[model samples]
Target: MVLSMPSPYKHPSTGVYWLKQRVPARLLAVAKGKSVTVTVDGMPCTVKLGDYIKVSLRTKTIAEAKQRANEAEAEFNRIWLSFENGPVKLTLKQITALAGEMYHAISAALEDDPGEAALWAQRRRERAEVGAKLKVSPAAALMIRPPSLEARLGSWVDGALKQHHLTVTPETYQRLLVEFDRAVGDVATLLERRSRGDYSPDAVAQRFPPVEIEQRVAAPKAAKAVGGDDPTTLTGLLAHKQRTQSKKDDTFDKYRGCLKNFIAFVGHEEVGRITKDDVRRWRDALIKRGLAKKTINDQYLTSLKVALNHGVKEFDLPTNVAANIRDERDAPAPTGSKGYSAEQAKTILQATFRGSSKNLEIPYQRALFWVPWICAYTGLRVTEVTQFRGRHLREENGIPYLLITPDDGSTKGKNAWTTGIHAHLIELGLLDMFRAIGDGPAFYTPYPEGTDLKSLSNHRAKSAGDKIADWVTDELGIAAPGDRPSHAWRHAFTTLSRTYKMDKEARDYMLGSRSQTDAREGYGDWSPEVVDAEINKLPRFDVEASDWRPSLELVPPRPLKSDLPPRRPLRVRKLRAKSA
Candidate 1:
């Protein structure tokens, strides 16, 4: 016997035919239901009725079902066409008459078939039972779509705050939003799993619990003046301080580490409850860990004090318990020396050319070659040099310069400044390196977008600096009484600037250091040309490292109009003279 092809209206799961049709966009909202399912000889079949009607002839025999289904479909189309052409609109009286007719027709149908009414009531009970199991009330189930987790949490928080008549600071408000979003996300994940039958309600509650809001009792005016049960912990205070303050990445990391250590030691206690003894004990513990007294004072003590002081001011606490605690006065200075000498700088640069101690990867080798040279010429901090991008390099009035700004990342004082690129660096192919790196960061390998952690970038750059330092110390056997190999270049730059009699304002501007005088010397409209002139005054290094040059040959891209700011004339101030 030959096999027959299946009909297009059949549903594979039920082995029964269905009549499917699309609902018109205009009638979808008012349509009673999309489709209805019926059983044909114990097999479920679907009849789809949109604004227009469609019917399926449900039968086991294929030949009989196809013939009957075509006849039913033709009859439905005829009735739908007649209804469509009959009337587009009706008067208010006519609408009332139609509503009466519908009500009477429904009542007659229920009165005529007691079994149909009973079956309908039974389904209603079953649906109510299922809704109860899902924790959805009958009224809630009537909603078109349930409110999202974020919306629900936001409304709850707003209601809680209003009920308590509480006002929170911007920092506190932001923290609450972050916490609520996290909680909502957790609850939402569990709800999704529960809906998909992957989790039971009890399992969901056990794994991801609901958020609880703490109750606040109404307090007297005097009690309110002193922060009453504010629930702000030491950790919260420290986080708020870091968010509000402008600090470099390295400095911020140190603060975070110090605060974390204090929290671990002292426990996450209330900020107002921490006493001076607690701070002193923490300091003593650091000292017992073999940390130098100076380290305890400078790193641990300073960070703790700042956090407590911030808490005192922000939370209106009675006192800063860590304020009166003093650092060890007789603590010895650090063992190793700081800053490099001229001779040491020469030896380091030469060793970089020779690849003296050990080999490095290409990216690291490139950083090793240029970072020291840039520091040697400009006295920039290692981070400052490493964070450079192609856009930071520009030409103003025919002179090339590096715009040491926080546009890309943090700066020393969180202030923007510009300095000229030394001529020797240009001769050593600095421009070529910028061209090779293109539009993003200039040094080290480019991280994939968001993965560029500031602390990690600084650490890697510092590691590269250390590698150069190690090469100078081990291979060249160069040592100074109080010198750091990479930082020695900065000292060397300062020395050369002073030796050549470069202007104090220009030198300070290049170094990004503050001037001694009360008057803001370089803040007013100083032209890049003047800064470039002072930077050019520094004498070039006369080294014999012939193979130390960068081999990059790409042409530098032209600077955009936004990169090169318009030049303004320097503001000159008149001096007052006194006569005796």
Candidate 2:
């Protein structure tokens, strides 16, 4: 029981004290379809509720109220017609106010700061104007390949912007500029694709420079030699190893650093003159300088082996100098393993499936998360998965699978082993993704001709896997496991298969690795259907495929400048009020 406050003025008709109306009399009476005796300053004002009630009913007589309502509605119609006719004049101040309001709505839609909307709009407007004047879109400046340039490259740029929270660095800007030119050069090719009714930007970008793994550094002397040396000379044993391993130039740089450090420690002795003892000393020095034993060993052995092998292959040295140097067996093996646990992996997958809001932020992060997840669950190597073509996917006996064949001139190593489709791949929703990418070899990395995107994808995948592993470790408040890579997913699959007590032969077949045999082929007894069945038998990840849908405007707004009315000075009071 609450006490009621006394009113200063009493209702004219009602003998009881009444408070002021809580809502607009016409709104409450007319909109709600209820008739109520509303108190206007404690006066009993009877108003009809519902749409039929006029706002002027309280002040005007019945006849006058009806007439006024008709006039007001007519005035509204005139204003609307003027707007449609482009004669609804607005001042600069009015346009700015409307723009501010529009920015707020757009910012809300994008879930970003409203303040940034003005900046984005201004930049977009400027870009449009520039493009119109130049008769080219910013994309036209990019030198992307045909279909690939349009499809994969454009999407990659958008995803990079969103996921990495990245901006173009001077180096990146230069690269983009180079790609822009390459893409532009492909205009003729793009036009052909368009003629065939396939002018998609992603397709153009992807098609622009096809992958060529045979690119070689200049080395005239040792053309038949496996490897070469000469730190300053790009070719040598280091070059051979890079080509054999299908590794990127950066990998060569790592070799250069590690090799230079070792050679400097061992002095400038000729290749055959450097003994196994010197190799051990350099290895120890690398270990002393805080290098991982694995890294130190890899670098030391590769460089030394290159020099020794180069001597044997090119300079006719009797024996490899560092052939007898044994690796330290007890160097305290690497302990900091890195990878997501089952639960952590599941959590990350869930976050990705929920989808990210629009921003130049989380959407890209989701892509990074998604790519690795797809790799892990599918048992595909990072390179194989990233360089996958759409044509690789096929269905047989009512089951979908990925048939991995090396693209034309794109085979790795000497043997062109055609791997059967893994039925488990369908569970990852890659089938649909492949379908969306259209016909052709779908690439993980869209590289120019003569550029090995495989190497770049490998390096990027490794780094991205590390970052995700670090994030997982941090989130779980646990130390990282061994610096496991996306390849570890393949390892994990094999390990899991073994743990589940699968047959040794079956496990080998399922993993697509060769079993020990004189035939040097995959287990002969395994049929394609059997291999497919075994792959399908594996546990499926409870993850949804990412929705890479196009964002279409529900209601396209008229261009602000084009929609503007004739310039007019608004009333002084209205302008001042607007400022306030």
Candidate 3:
């Protein structure tokens, strides 16, 4: 039997000691939640820590409980202090003083005979650029992106933050960037001075006040003092939901992230103890963070409400506390369907024939040229378009169809079925492109190993889609907050199909939208010829992109994600604390 435990609270019936403490008041709101390393079955499991900390002493004796209690309490205080809003705000002069120190170190380092040839070559190029800018506008020279920025960026800033107990803001960071440029530029100017054989007294270096450094007091590590309680946490519910249900992996990831943030803001894991007030505080905090009201309501708030609603049924939650909490759109919903106009659609399609301005990879450049055309003709989500494999292209009774499903990558819905390949896409030599790529993902590869966010849900398809979207926005200059460039294709497809009087059921099938009224909708499959007929009726984009068609080897054999490096869950969890 265990001799001791934290004696703050005791199980009266079982006569076991426990430690129960209210979460510190200051950390009741947060921008995001962090993983707290916890232990279960002697294995380390990370949990979204909640509002109160309750630990079982696992000992019955008073003296032993007190000793454990002391240790637990000490560690708790240390972690709480770390999370609390840190150090007094740095004054403008003090901030300048910190930047001044960076100037001295950089100038002095370049003063002597430098080490490596490559380093000198790189630095010499950076130094030359600074020298040219200094000649034009010495004041503007420091405003250039800091060349010697990284050398002392961490040590100088970290030392000052710790010394004065300061937190840097974006505004302060902008100032520091200018100050660092000044430091590096001054070094460049000094080097030029030395080369000219005039060893003059350095005026700029003498102006900076020294950044004071102080000895730091190390605190007890959280893993050493931290312990876990086996209770239903908000994120734990999401895990259980994922295991039990058939839902989109991406959606689950989003919900998991939202609930973790909520739990962290409230400060604990005990679901029964959660209050509506706690959730309100979190929502209010999100609002203060200047998140768009739509984002706050749809993504953040809605996610919590959905998770808790499930927790009510599956995990025996008392009630869905966040059920009705929502941020009503602060402004009226913007009127207008998010679809490209005929002219805009043609422009976007025509531009695909031209080379990408961004240095896109071969596969991605192919996606840039083809995805919009495919999206224009087929109305497929950007992901569905990118997931194309040669085998996915099949002939049904002399009509070709592309398969849309989760077998390749994450798709939005369960409407996994054949979609007729528009004749327009075929006309653009899509078939040849598909054949050249072979039986492999046409647009993306398995994310390389050691990717920080490599997961079943956060796959490379999204990355491919994002690359296409960025090009459409930046190169095409089609950026609007209400309308997404990639997604607007869906709206345009629906509109054109309606205008052409294509069968609603065929249109719905192509879009993967579920038919709520008719149960027969899911029973039978659409003939590729029939769908192809309706697809042709919708009409093709009048613009030509034949020149943009791929001539290079488009895709290699399909990448095996299973062969890639295993997922490394914790870059941070591995930091000093693995398991307590």
RMSD values, in order shown: 30.9, 30.7, 15.8
Question: How displaced is residue 80 in candidate 1, in Å?
Answer: 81
**Winner by TM-score:** 3
Candidate 2 C-alpha lDDT tens digits along 1-580? 0012122233467433322212333233323543333223223334443433222223324444333333333222222222222212233333233223323333234332223334545544554464364445443454222343335344433332222112333324334433443333343333334444552443323222221111111122434444343422323555655655554455567666656554434323345455665576566545544666676567667766665675576555777767766456567755532344566456655554543343422223433444555555555555555455556666667755555444522223312333344443454455665676555433322223344433342332233344444444434333324534455566656655555554656555444555455465543454556656555455766656665432211212222233468788633211111000
Taking the tens digit of each residue's C-alpha lDDT, what string does model 3 give over 121-179?
46657856755765787444433333354354545565434333344553455455556
- lDDT per prediction? 0.55, 0.43, 0.64
TM-score of every prediction relative to native: 0.50, 0.45, 0.61
- Which candidate number has the best lDDT? 3
lDDT measured at residue 424 in model 1 versus the true structure, 0 to 100? 82
| Cα lDDT, model 1, residue 46 | 45
Look at candidate 1 and give me any clashing residue pairs. 340-488
- The number of clashing residue pairs in model 3 is 6
Error of 2 at 192 (Å): 63
When summed lDDT is taken over every stretch of 10 residues in candidate 3, the lowest stretch is: 571-580
Error of 3 at 271 (Å): 1.9
By lDDT, rank the candidates, best first.
Answer: 3, 1, 2
